[model samples]
Target: MARLCLPDGAVRGIDIQGAQTGTVTSYTAGRDGTVTVDNPQHERALRQYGAFPANLGGRSTRGGYRCGVCGFAAYIKTCSRCGGTCEKES
Candidate 1:
């Protein structure tokens, strides 16, 4: 199982293939901006959608970057949403 964390109040939609069939399943973040994925496919889908893995202690891991233009936070050095430079966050 995988636990993905997003910014507080952020919402994300994830689409993954069903385990037993070819159907596509969709998932959304919960009220606290977290999603728990029970399958590897779901985990990959959530990561692709910009959700990062949550630390084991239930807090977001630090040392990532936050976009200056759109305020998106991720591990990447560049902002994928607005093509803006990202500043490292403590």
Candidate 2:
């Protein structure tokens, strides 16, 4: 069981509350530095990493994203969505 961080919001960034146990349902990360957790309980821990609910409808930048803003290299090849844009995080 891994812990997930769920931060409501802040200036510096999100934070981790605690941990949980569950199989990862789904994940989404784009070129942006963020990660979304589909696991219900892990929501709190996910925030610590800097993930937030995106306007993309429960979508957030999946792991392995390359953030040009932060010079972060994305490991995952952009996700596929209907409008060509990754539906994970806008």
| Top-TM-score candidate index | 1
* Per-model TM-score versus the true fold: 0.48, 0.25
Expressed as tens digits, the lDDT of each residue in 24-83 for candidate 1 is 876677776567888787787667666776652223537877788877765688887788
TM-score of 2: 0.25
What lDDT score goes with residue 5 in model 2? Answer: 32
**Worst 10-residue stretch by lDDT in candidate 2?**
80-89
Compose the digit string of candidate 2's lDDT tens values, residues 1-90: 322332335333443443443333343443353455545555644544555444322233344443334333333444322122221123
Clashing residue pair totals per candidate (backbone < 3 A):
0, 17
